[model samples]
Target: MPRFGEDYHHFHSQPEPSAAYSTSLSSWAPSEQQRSLPPPRWSSSASWFVPPTRLLALLLLLTVALQPALARALDEEGEGSGDGGKGGDFSVDMYHIPKPFQFVETPRDMQVIEERAASFFCHTSDAAEVSVQWRKNGQAILPSSTTASAEDVPGGSVLTILPKMKDNNATFECVAENALGDTISAQASLTVYEDNANAIPEGFPQFRLAEMEEEEPDKFPVFWPLAIEVEPDVLEVNCEATGDPEPKIKWFKSMRPLELKNPRYSVLAPGRLQIKISREEDDGTLYSCMAVNEKGVVFSGVFGLYHLE
Candidate 1:
């Protein structure tokens, strides 16, 4: 045998391969093989091969194309539904009938000295729209009268009288009227007394101090000048006084006048003061009582309160 190198060279130097063999070899190459293979078989329709971006674009176009048709259909349906339809032309009327004339405030019974002028007020709920009139003893009171006169007020009318002994035991009423209806208030009476010197002497009022009892053992008296520690308890202070003329008693806290009408405080008589202790704020509160008359005035010593811990 010849040498191996000499034999390989002699075999490669043979004639070119056949056309069919060359074609098969070319198909075996990576690029050519991929191109020659058959396409893959899908389980479903060709739509599965569509890209997600293209599918999203197609959906958006469909929605935009259908919007105007959907709107037109809704409008036609609304028109057929009559007044109850959405976006349909309609109106609603709301009204309230006028309320009948009613009294808001009425005059109270009054007592006055002889030859003194007194005024009675009559108020109504709708005074600006309603007409107000005053009547005395079932007879209409004239606006131009020497002894009595009726005058228009902001919310009602006023009946003023220059009282005499003959005007005693008289009845007065307020009448309110409007287009809707009319109403009359309860009758108010006037009492007149003769002015006598012996009944009340002309002099200044006098005041006297008194102690109040404690409700609890730890509680302090209301009239103590020094601060006293006390538990939560109701407290009371009373000032007794006598004068030539009767005096009115008023209570004060920290120099401010106390409202006697408050439910927390009570003025049993002119001089007595009662307080209910409900909170810690009542501690260290300065309290004073005063008596007033036509002639003069008197005040009690200031007292302080504190809460007991």
Candidate 2:
């Protein structure tokens, strides 16, 4: 038999064994086969080893097997390390959250005369450690002559205003702030009325008196006087006058000032004086209406009442 060489077997096909020898191949000695057969050779290049498709399949299976474990590890890191997650170190409890600011008492609208003092009040609930501030028309209010100051009270703050003409019809509000956030109260209105009486001329009772009338008369006499006829009943007279600095009116009976506190006597709108007189002594009583301003005082002519009984 030809000696089997590594290159010979690699290049050519081996001869077929005879039937009689093939049936008795197991009877051959292992030492004789080991001495006779040349050492088997393996390809040094990797290209002859495994198919590309099978290698790719194996890598894909390995990746699929490890996917769940990788995802679990990432989830644990996110939960335990960073902020804002439920299991995070910096997570905040829902029950222990800081309370948001709320208004307990809001400021109310008010009116004041010029140069008068007014105060606005604002309170908040759960205001501990929170800061309160005052604002006017969305701007912060500062201490000045017009705005006196703001002070803290028991549960809130009070803003004092020395009202001036420029502050008329201004809106004010209160703001409270804390770590959580800030809240604003409803706006309060401030109305300042003008004080024209302060600028009156330097003269006592420097005013003019116009002709008085009780009822319409068809003719005007040189000396027209106001007269009225009434039974023992209620009497009302309206005395309308206009003067600088807005005049104030008063009524007198027999040169005596009328007592305003008496319920029987009333002063009505447009300077009308009403008296409940149901006595004989009130007949022919001299009644006069007087208007006074900062400048001076003026009186209406005495009106005589004739009793018709």
Candidate 3:
């Protein structure tokens, strides 16, 4: 043991080991063949002894076993010593991505026609493959002669339909969708106008005149082939309304509703109600006119009839 300790010192301090020392150690060392032989069995009395290397290895293993538990204990104690709110605080861990999609309602300015029609404009940040369909009373529109089809629009899509072609009053809808999600617009009513040519002002567009004939006449249908002539100073007004359920017309002269009994006025037809007011009196004035059925109302463009005379 003394010799081995002295040799370890010389290995670090001396310049180098001579080849003679190597030769002497090689001659004294056991050969690989001899070392491979089984170690001699230890007696019961010798079993108590442990090699220094084995003792050191055991000590290291024991230290490793205690370290993790000690670390956990220190962590627990530190956490208990501070604010409870800070103890459990952690960053938000998002688990899953959510779908993105939204909807915009159809413009109220749209005139409801014979066929049901509403449009939903979809807005979304994500690009997606989308499909939109309209359903009424929870029934899908199928391939049919009168059934309206779904059309694609920018950033989304729209579905149009004639919910019930036979009945002038069917509910309509607009639906928009994309791969991420779907959105729906509220129900709307359709107005199927039947043409009563006599009821249309004679000068009104030919297409609109045809609409009056579509429905059975409720009252003596009247038509105005020639809209009454008006001077530049006069404000001329005419109105026509249609609906599954018949629509009514209300006229306002300036801010007040007008009575047709005046000698200056004549009611030629039910729908072709006309009004003439001198521009010298009514210029720069705003008038409100509305057409209404059970389902809804449509207001007309503001009319200004006169300038400062």
Instruction: Give the alpha carbon lDDT tens digit for every residue of 12-130 in model 3.
Output: 55444444344565566544544554434434235366788999999999999997886677667668878743554435677887645655445232233333222323333335665
RMSD of each: 26.4, 24.6, 20.6
User: By TM-score, how accurate is candidate 2?
Assistant: 0.32
Name the candidate, 1 or 2, with the larger TM-score value: 1
Q: What would the per-residue lDDT of candidate 1 be over residues 151-269, giving only the tens digit for each residue?
A: 66555776767777888899988887764666556568887655432422345344554344444332111233332223347666766666667777766665555656778776666
Rate residue 103 of model 1 by lDDT.
Answer: 73
User: Residue 226 CA error for candidate 1 (Å)?
Assistant: 40
Q: How many clashes does the backbone of model 2 have?
A: 4
**Between the candidate structures 1 and 3, which one is better when assessed by TM-score?**
1
Model 2 agreement with the true structure over 1-309: per-residue lDDT tens digits: 333344456434544444424456676434443356555555544345677798999999999999788767766776776643434223336767655567778877765545644567677776565567888888988765355678775446767667778987899988876555665566688776554434433332322334323353321111212433233466677676666667777676654555578886778765677777746766788777666564444455567665666
Which has the higher lDDT value, candidate number 1 or candidate number 2? 1
Q: What ranges in model 2 sit over 4 Å off?
A: 1-100, 144-146, 196-309
Q: How much is the lDDT of residue 11 in candidate 1? A: 54
